[model samples]
Target: MHSRKPFYLLVALLFISGLAASIYRGIEHNVPFLPGKQVQSWAVDAKVRFQATGEPAEVSFSLPEDPAYEVLVENATSPGYGLSITSDEEGRRAIWSIRQARGQQDLYYKVTLIPTGVKQILATEEPATPEPYSWPATEQAAAEQAIEEVWSRSATNLSFAQQLNKALTASERSQNIELLLSSNRPAQLFVRMLNSKGIPAQAVSGLFLEDQRRRQQLVTFVEVYHDGQWHLFNPVDGSQGRPDNLLIWDRSGKSTLDVIGGINSQVNFSMLQDTRSALATSIDVMMNNDALDFSLYQLPLEEQSLFKGILLIPIGVLMVVFLRVIIGIKTSGTFMPVLIALAFIQTTLLTGLIGFLLIVAFGLTIRSYLSKLNLLLISRISAVIIVVIGIIGLFTLLSYKFGLSEGLTITFFPMIILAWTIERMSILWEEEGAKEVFVQGGGSLFVATLAYLAMSASWVQHWVFNFLGIHLVILAMVLLMGQYTGYKLLELRRFKPLAGE
Candidate 1:
């Protein structure tokens, strides 16, 4: 054992070196092997600049809404300001409150947006019917007459709104409609006139998120409710639908920002497009640490799925090595315990244990009777195979009939291997007596259980799958175990009589 230590140490060194190199390559490539979801994400970084006075300062900015898109996470940097986000009956807003300050101050807020792929237009708590606008007397009659003319030409609510929308914003509009635009914004004016005619309508501001845009202005649209749904129409061209990338902003029709004690307080946006594992990204952001960033970040999702389970097998093998070589667990076969452990993972611990015990106990009874026929070794195993399968079938039917779905997973156990295990235990009982047979059989289950626990662990599964070096580390540990020449833990117990002497 002493002489072989050098060889084992070298093997361990090589495994470590190989693992390091693989991890390095994985890191360079950004093929994430980590156990989590891979999500395509967008980082919308917004900067708000203002010059603060030496008094209390408060800044409020309206936030985005849902059913259009979702804010997955958000963070802000305000060197001297205290930031707080609040939501009310009106809408959600971020408020930065400061006690006192002087000179130019820059406050930054970053929002990560994820497309939900499902749209739902949220209902505001406004009256079931829209309230008519209060306009100056001269404009009121002209707006009402113009809206009446459009409403008369159109039949459906949507069509009336569309026709009205066009007449108000058309480049060569009629005298009444063009005068309305000159004094008021087309979208808002059209909505008020619409309400005057008893149709529920409102103007909304939104952002069309396409490319990196700075100091972007909100695009307004007129929305009319009919048939239990809100329909958006472009105020400029009377277009019927919103852009696929539209983000509804300032929906409550509130001012985007309210600032006191700050001059020229304005927001600028800088956006970057990147993809990350959605499940892992939040954790990564929360940790504020990137020490574990590896190349296995964005490999094909299917390949990542394959490696996750595959990598855990080595850890199971290491468990088997330590149990058999160092602890002297007398399993029926070498390396078979690892496969059993894998099956246990699918079936779960308690159910698998119960199923395994039931099958083996029943198999042993059949094996004893088979021995009476005086058959050859191959014939015996083949006969046991048929019987073991029959046993599995019977158990599955009974379990299913009784509604124990977990027992159905018993099929994942290697049927052939179970047959062999029954045969080995039977033969071992005949040769070494019943006590030894029970000891070895129970030991196999014991070691396999330990292996399952190690492989099924969350962190172990993550490390092995993500870092190709983890298998190397497992190999190194197994090699180190191989150099253990001292008495097995069980062997040491056997020396109790010698010590008693």
Candidate 2:
């Protein structure tokens, strides 16, 4: 006897691998397991305004970067100016240059990103020793005293920096704390103090994102090298780690915007937060990243849409298998219901059903008349196909004349399938009478309707399209159903007398 073990093993493998891939994509790519989950996306617009000096002019604007978000799109708008984007160890920058410019000038930069809600940890290469700041004599004395006091209270570099920030921003500050705050910004002082103690640190600019906010300015945050990575801290509140809504825009410790040969140069930001389909947002994020992902989302829009319908066929096939093997439904032809159900997706349920019934009814009438002509099998089938097309065209014209636009979609049905179906039913009618034809035809329609309902569901479409691995699970199910050799559900009634005996 042949072993069923190999078949079961293959089925288990397919099921497990398909489930794992789907779950992994859902978690790693931020794709929700269900549909309609919304993701927050931010649209930021930066406006750079300055007065041109009627000579050559150039402006460099720093771009935003954060590990918590993935940028989907970035663009710049500057008329009559050459724009060049450059990326380096520092970060990305947009440079706009123009010759013989005059009067006021405005350059705009726009970007869209979906936040991943992951915290940012600043990382950099080994840093060179920082140069000592040239502080005034009294201020210098205060600095040393403040650093020594904060150092005594803390052990590690992160703790030391946090304590220094706490001391600088305290409400009731000491004499040295007051001296330090009077001369420098809290973030700058925090970094200088950390550097003075031989720790690597820098003052970076972070933007606090708010919905529908205009004229937004960058806030200073201190970054200190600790435990092999740089950590961000709020100098004002001594809070460690990055804020969820705060975007680190400038980390180079340089000016965020620089305009040469222009006066009163400044940059202003406006941002709006919106929600979008989580799946679409996740797909966009994956496309933007360098990670290896296998998904239909990578296909072109047209092909992706086609695949959306194609992928649904397996679902209809599964329904057909269950109905035929387990329920003992007698379809006119195997797999025909799946094609009909797919057509129903385009033409919709009620309209497709009505259209299918009318086309087959008319085609069978014409086919019955042609069957008496002694035509060859191929010629008869080909003639039936032509007759089906004519019947559909006639129905469409009639539908349009009567203002029934849905009937126009009847053409979406496969003409060849309809032809073959009509020919089979006609032949069945001649051999076994009309009752068997109706039984098979009705069964096919019943199966197709059920399949259509399953395949057309929003959640079903979302899963099948987003997760191709699911088809394997469906295939395994169909294969397992193929192994069923017991009496069909409809055949059980014939054994009722035997059971009673």
- Estimate the TM-score of every prediction: 0.53, 0.91
Highest lDDT against the true fold, candidate: 2
lDDT of 1 by residue, 1-501 (tens): 358667866886878786776577455433345556576666777677888887788999888765666576788888777989999876888899989978887888888876655575746544477666787987978877887799889999878888887776677888888778888877778788788877888777787675666676678877788777788888877678768877777767667777898898777666666777754654444233344454344557787776676677888889889888887888888877888888898899888899889999999999999999999999999999999899999999999999989989999888998999989889899999999988888888999999999988886776675556666777777777876889988888778999999
Model 1 RMSD vs true structure: 22.1
Query: Cα lDDT for residue 342, model 1?
Result: 84
- Quick one: how many clashes does candidate 1 have? 10
Which regions of candidate 2 are displaced past 4 Å? 122-136, 290-301, 371-375, 495-501
Off by over 4 Å in 1: 1-38, 124-126, 278-501
Predicted structure with the largest TM-score when compared to the true one: 2
lDDT of 2 at 464: 94
